[model samples]
Target: MGITYRRILLKLSGEALMGDLSYGIDPAVVNGIAEEVSEIAATGVQIAIVVGGGNIFRGVKGAAAGMDRATADYIGMIATVMNAMTLQDALEHLGVPTRVQTAIAMQEVAEPYIRRRAIRHLEKGRVVIFGAGSGNPFFTTDTTAALRAAEISADVLFKATKVDGVYDADPAHNPNARRFQSLTYSHVLTHDLKVMDSTAIALCKDNNIPIVVFDLSVTGNVRRAVMGESIGTIVGGLCEVC
Candidate 1:
């Protein structure tokens, strides 16, 4: 068997957890994701996950209504905890060893974010889910994924989205939008592509960690990306780095 990545960070948006529901968690979708993750873990690949909470709450939404930015961000952080807890349960139910670590100190529910402990868990074949969005306000989960990838020394940041790859335009909006099989970090910046937030792109570029953007809606894309299959858009560096 060929194991391409010894370790990787998988980023899942909160919307991905929504399934067919308009909002909130969907058990079936969460279970399907857990199943895929469990299969990938069986390959001996160290996995660290960063999950978004857009389905539950978006900080900007609260801020738009005159709420304090910091307070709204805290609410957003709690939303991530909810999502993290759900994912933890699903992964454990699937018989995959997992840990939930939050940026905010939450000793009662999950472990406090500790880089060393997280690394240890991955080394021991346990999946680590990072929540709370960098433990700070004004930062998106995409930035958190890049930060965690660098901190964990992951081989690549696998950005799981609904789309299979980065396109010249919003494929959903533009039928003629074309996907780029590969792109450099500079190219992404120059084009102002929407592959990730600017902060995330800058962090990945600085840390020399490549990113793979693929469709998590597909059943096996997660495992395929970790296996080094050409199933998504390769960004930041050459395919060899990923």
Candidate 2:
């Protein structure tokens, strides 16, 4: 199949990198993901990634222990930086030219997030990884993904999750959970679907950017998603009528 998107934003949860381990980066898992990304890059899809920091630091967990909200969030952002570095190194080792940009402005390690620079990198077939959660404390990485997708003029946001698609309930917990092949922003909001956070969903709706939620655990799912093979539950677009 032909590529589904010319330029796409991929949202990868930190937990996905943990692999069989309880916490932190798993080199084997990182390598596996990097290889998948390389495959997509070879297919000529300009891929930009937004990585979460949950595996390293959870702001809610820190807040429950008396840590200040902003302080905890800053720590979480730092965790994302670490994760970005790990992914960048893995992608580079696989021969994929990569650039790590941070919202928090880490001049020593990464370039400050510049939209034009990022787009230029993508045009040159370089993967740009976005880190630091929008450089704001109150926002989640999900929201960051939406914002970045809009800013980069991405055709779609490929949300890589453990589950194959958006379901009415947790598929792992509820065997009878209903999977949605396609949905609209209204449907997601009306049913309070947890496929993405409200802020992120709202942003996508406003920007008219489509979201494809699919299983990253599957070896070739990334390529399939990028190829527009209907491998996931698509949400937030006029295509919901189809």
Candidate 3:
């Protein structure tokens, strides 16, 4: 199949790494993701990843429990780095050369996030994984994914979610929830579709990056999304990317 996106930024939530478990990373899931990534990279598509840390820790939840917001967020960012390392190991085990970069500095673990360096890695056929959620208090990994996609000029952003796509309501709760096959940026913002945080959607809108929200639980769906198949909800200008 023809690859529609020459380069893509994949946004993976930490909870995705949990698979059937309620907490922490699952080796099988990470390995499956790495295999998919390796297959795509073999097609000469450069890939970068931004991972969230909700599985290990969620800053918003901690903050809701009355801890310092900034400190909780920082811990959450560090959790992302751990997830990043696990992903890196899985990718490397699959013989995919991967680099993990963090917004926070930790020379012992990973290179600090440098836009130029990340782009260089992609150019050299290395999958670069970004962690640490912009190293800020309130900003989320969704925003980090958008920011990194823009910085790298990724052709598209793939958001892997548990659900199939963007819906008017929670599909689990409402059987009548309408799934959108295509959408505009403003539509998502106005309707509050929860495709991503408002900041993330706005950043992607500003940079003209198309986002594909697909069901990660489906095997081969990742590859299908890369081929521009209509297997998910596409946000942004449909004619351009979908």
Off by over 4 Å in 3: 238-242
- Pairs that collide, model 3: none
1 or 3, greater by TM-score: 3
TM per candidate comes to 0.96, 0.96, 0.97
| Leading candidate by TM-score | 3
| lDDT digits (tens) for residues 63-143 of candidate 2 | 889999889999999999999999999999999999999999899999999999999999999999999989999789999
Q: Write down the lDDT of every candidate, Cα atoms only.
A: 0.91, 0.91, 0.94
**TM-score computed on alpha carbons, candidate 2:** 0.96
lDDT of 3 at 161: 92
**Tens digit of per-residue lDDT, candidate 1, span 1-242:** 37788999999999999988999999999999999999989878899999999999999899999999888888998899899999999999989999999999999999999999999999999999998989999999999999999999999999999889998889889999888888899888877888999899999999999999999999988878887899879996553222
| Candidate 1 regions with alpha-carbon error over 4 angstroms | 238-242
Clashes of each: 0, 0, 0
The local lDDT score (0 to 100) that residue 176 gets in candidate 1 is: 99
Give the TM-score (vs. native) of candidate 1.
0.96
The C-alpha local distance difference test score for the whole of candidate 1 amounts to 0.91
